[model samples]
Target: MTKEEAPVLLEVRGLAAKAGSAQILKGIDFTVRAGEVHAIMGPNGSGKSTLSKVLAGHPAYEVTAGTARFDGQDLLAMAAEDRARAGFFLSFQYPVEVPGVANAQFLRLAYNSIQGARGRDELDPLEFDDYVREKMKLLEMAPAFLDRSLNTGFSGGEKKRNEILQMALLEPRLAFLDETDSGLDIDALRVVANGVNTLRNDDNAVVLVTHYQRLLNYIVPDYVHVMDGGRLVKTGGKELAIELEARGYDWIQKSAA
Candidate 1:
């Protein structure tokens, strides 16, 4: 089926949000259908990241107006953990470092929690070990990573890979990845991008929040959106990203003016 024919995974209309007293998202309308990759691109403080945080039900942001429906249900009304249980996943740009938790333990608990919520059988430690290791291989991550503290002392690349590994294990229906390409070397970028690509299928969708077109070269988004002044100003095909790279965002600002 074509993208337009696919089922709508997320729909937003007049989405306005704020962090504390500052309004971020301003009257945004967006949609995502299954089997598509969408890239939200903009300069610093354009609300690209804020959009994802709001959809994921982050506590810091308040939805002042508009509606967000995920899989035909009220998204803003659901709790953050409930959003995850309903197949909504958001990868943080900065993966937090949990000092005492082993990476494997963290992954297993998260996987089992979601599984139980879905009424699927929860895997025990041994069962989950085998399952997660297979997922880790997709990211080319070493087994040693499972034993280390979650994101603690991990290099930038390792942390990103760990985040993707979580995505692989949970297999979210809709993933909102925030600045996933930041601070990665070339090799790491390819590995992480490859992992994301491998996880893609006609049954799911990915929404990427990024600043540069370089990530698009690997992920190949079906649609590219440019945001400015807390609103989505323009949207085009993958080639729009190429234009942004060459000409800069100045024209976008002028055109929207």
Candidate 2:
């Protein structure tokens, strides 16, 4: 059986959301099962990012209406921390830079925090370093990066690779990478996509929110869903992504209607 035939990990029905007074998502609907790599594609300001934020449980975007459940539990009912502990991960488009926090230290704290929440043993700094370094090797990142401040004085590719490193360590059941391809050159894009592809499995699901089809070339998606006018307008296989690349999103709006 395919990912669709597998158990559903996420279910969004009639999802409506807003940023302050301006409404964004309008009755959006979709379902993602375990083992699926779903690509959410659309034009700028088409509520693509908004949908990812809403699903990630961002405080700035309010869920005005609708229901979303993850692993049969209520998603909106859980706190952000709870969501993370429950195996939800979101890699930001623009990974933040911290001047004082070392990458290793930050990752350790985050890892241990989630471990504590899950009633698992927290790794010591030395143990975590060993574990994290092994994971970093998958992304072809150097050990020197661990000593630096988080994303500080790093290239765009380094920042994105760091995000994927965190995802590898967390091993989230549902991972949503928002605009991960933004500002990346071909080399960086391939490296980041390789990391993402490595993490995908038959038991976990990934949702990649991207604008361009170039990223899809490196990481083929099991499903492509188009977002326009604050709602999911179309769903198809990877072919839809290739078509979107050839014809552009303007062709989707008519099909969206």
Q: What would the per-residue lDDT of candidate 1 be over residues 1-257, giving only the tens digit for each residue?
A: 78899999999999999999999999999999999999999999999989999999999999999999999999999999999999999988999999999999999999998999999999989999999999989999999999999999998888889999999988899999999999899999999999999999998999999999999999999999999999999999999999999999999999999
lDDT by residue (1-257, candidate 2, tens digit) is 75558999999999999999999999988888999889999999999888877888889988889999999999998888888889999998888899999999999999998889889999999999899999998988999999999999988878888999999999899999999888788888888888889899888999999998889888888899999999889999999999999999988898667
Give candidate 1's TM-score.
Answer: 0.99
Clashes of each: 0, 0
What is the model-wide C-alpha lDDT for candidate 2?
0.90
List runs of model 1 lying over 4 Å from the truth.
Answer: none
Off by over 4 Å in 2: none
What residue pairs clash in candidate 2, if any at all?
none
